[model samples]
Target: MKFLIDAQLPVRLSYLLKSMGHDAIHTKELALKNATPDTEINAISIREQRIVITKDSDFWDSFYVNQEPYKLLLVTTGNISNKELESLFIKNLGQVVDLLEQHSLIEMSRDSVIVHQ
Candidate 1:
């Protein structure tokens, strides 16, 4: 799956996704870098058909209100170390991918993954 990692997430997450053999890009790679607005990000997500992976609830709100991004993977794990975050992805990514294939929105907490209607 293709992914557009939001500004709040580390660039390393993009690299991790790439390492897992998916097409992924961090917002830092954008022309506006981390300052890229949510609208532009949503546009990119729609145009590129990339699943937006973010911790930002604004995107969560937009997903329900506007549904412009096409797909979303919300990180609701709260505060955690980068390693812990990466580990969470590593452990649950397979299930996450399967869930995303059928659901427009999926939430990943520290211990479990939730599929949102």
Candidate 2:
């Protein structure tokens, strides 16, 4: 899967995804860097057919309200260290990928991954 990692997420997440054999890019790689607006991110996601991985609830709202981005992975694990976050991905990424293959919205917390209708 291809991914556009949001600014709120660590760039390391992109590397992890890439290492796992997925194409991924962090917001830092964009011309606006971490400052890229959500709308532009949405456009990129749609144009490139990338799943948006973000902690921002704004994307969540937009996903439901506008269906702007093609797909979304919303991280709801609040205030965790980057290592813990990466570990969470390592543990659940397979299931997450399977779910995303069939669903447009997914929520990942510290303990579980939820597939949204």
Candidate 3:
């Protein structure tokens, strides 16, 4: 899967995803480095065909209400560190994909990965 990691997500997560053979790009790597407007991110995500991985709920709302072109992974872990985020993704990538394939939105929280179709 192709992924566009949100600014809040550690850039290392993108590297790890790429190492796992998935295409991933950090927000800083995008052209809109200094500007992370919601519409811009959504537009770029759609244009690039990349699933957005973010900690922000706005992206979920944007994709959900707008029925945007790509998928979204909304992380809801509380006060998480970079290592925790990466570990979570590493430990549950397969399950994540399964959820994503079955639903349009996947929310990875402290307790579970919630899926919404």
Candidate 4:
């Protein structure tokens, strides 16, 4: 699947996704800093058909309440180091994919990845 990593996530996570053969883009690559609004990201995700990967809960409003069909991968693991975050994605990307097929939201935490369909 395609993905656009939010500024809150390590930009390098995009590399992890790309390494796994998925199309991915980071905010930096888009020249979008922290100021990029959630709605804008949601729009871009819809336009590009890319899933939105973020740690921010505000995007939930855009994806769920606002009824944005763009896929969402929310990392709710408390503030963590970059390495830890990378490991989480690398280790569980398969399950992540499975969840995505069945749900719009995957709240990836340290212990488990919760799916919200």
The CA-based lDDT of model 4 is what?
0.85
Candidate 1 matches the true fold with a TM-score of 0.98
Write out the backbone clash pairs for model 3. none
Error of 4 at 68 (Å): 2.0
Error of 3 at 81 (Å): 1.3
Which candidate has the highest lDDT of all? 2
Worst 10 residues of 1 by lDDT: 108-117
Error of 4 at 112 (Å): 0.2
Off by over 4 Å in 2: none
Give the alpha carbon lDDT tens digit for every residue of 1-117 in model 2: 999999999999999999999999999999999999999999999999999999999999999999978899999999999999999999999999999989999999999899885
Query: In candidate 4, what residue range of length 10 has the lowest lDDT sum?
Result: 29-38
Model 4 sits at a Cα RMSD from the real structure of 1.3
User: Residue 90 in candidate 4 has what lDDT?
Assistant: 86
**Clashing residue pairs for model 4:** none
Per-candidate TM vs. native? 0.98, 0.98, 0.91, 0.93
